[model samples]
Target: MVYEIGDNANSALKVVDRVTETLRGDQWQPTVSVNEAREKVRIFVKQTDGLVDGLVVMVVGEADKHHGDTGNEAVFVNIVGEIDPAELGRITKKLNIDVDV
Candidate 1:
């Protein structure tokens, strides 16, 4: 089932914590970690017939830049299945613009 993560910061943090624990376990080893301060995170899951086909975690935030440099940053995590990379890109774009992703 699709779960819409709540908009509250605490809710987002909770989801991140749960996902972190899951990733730390042997069952699910995330390819990368983008846990950072003041970042937005999105978890995408594509499912069919009650079975998950793909999963992606995206994190966006301001880049750590030198003086006078524009700061921009983005992170995309693909967990499983054959979900389109472009689709994940679109989701990330939307999440970057939306405060309540």
Candidate 2:
């Protein structure tokens, strides 16, 4: 049977969900901050394979109250633990984001 556009989209979503579930296990979920004007989700990702220490990622809303005018920065953060600043900077650069701890 030929799949319609909607079917393809749904299949893609399912695939995405599966990938997310698989990858998310290694990454910690963000904690919500209620007091802040905009809710911020902070997650700490522990390093694996004897790499450097974990890093923190903050997911904030796109609302102006969250200090995000473009609302494109769904994830923001800086490196934490035993890691090099330069390395973190490189990663942030690759991600097209400015890391803030």
Candidate 3:
């Protein structure tokens, strides 16, 4: 399960940042962080030994959180490929997120 981050594209990207902010050290290599649209963003991460070679993570948020949203939560997170669970857990813990795989 994922967390209800926020509404709108910016919020979705912020979630990505929150998850990646601590992805430092020689073991991690972030290739790019790009905004595909006003309401979407994608981030690619590559482990030194090439653990993840595809879309590391991407997020898409609703344009209008209040249009038909009652709870106003519209952030969507998509993670592709795989990473070391222990490393991921350490990162998530610092971000106040839970890791369960």
Which candidate achieves the best lDDT against the true structure? 1
Error of 1 at 74 (Å): 17
User: If ranked by lDDT, best first, what sequence of candidates would result?
Assistant: 1, 3, 2
**Judged by lDDT against the true structure, how good is candidate 2?**
0.45
Local accuracy by lDDT, each model: 0.52, 0.45, 0.47
lDDT of 1 by residue, 1-101 (tens): 22333333455456566766765563443433545565655564656665556775756554434545254444446657755545655655654434232
Model 2: per-residue Cα lDDT over 1-101, one tens digit each:
11222212334334334534553676743322222443333344556565657665444333453453533234445565777645766765565444453
Task: Give the Cα error of residue 23 in candidate 2, in Å.
Answer: 9.6
Off by over 4 Å in 1: 1-11, 23-26, 29-32, 40-52, 56-82, 97-101
Cα RMSD, each candidate: 9.2, 10.0, 9.3
Worst 10 residues of 2 by lDDT: 1-10
Better of 1 and 3 by lDDT: 1
lDDT per residue (tens digit) for residues 1-101 in model 3: 34454443456566667666655442345554444433343344554354653335444444454466433233333355675645665644543333342
Q: What is the TM-score of each predicted model, taking all chains together?
A: 0.38, 0.31, 0.38
Candidate 2's error at 25, in angstroms?
Answer: 7.8
Which runs of model 2 end up more than 4 angstroms from their true locations?
A: 1-35, 52-58, 65-85, 93-101
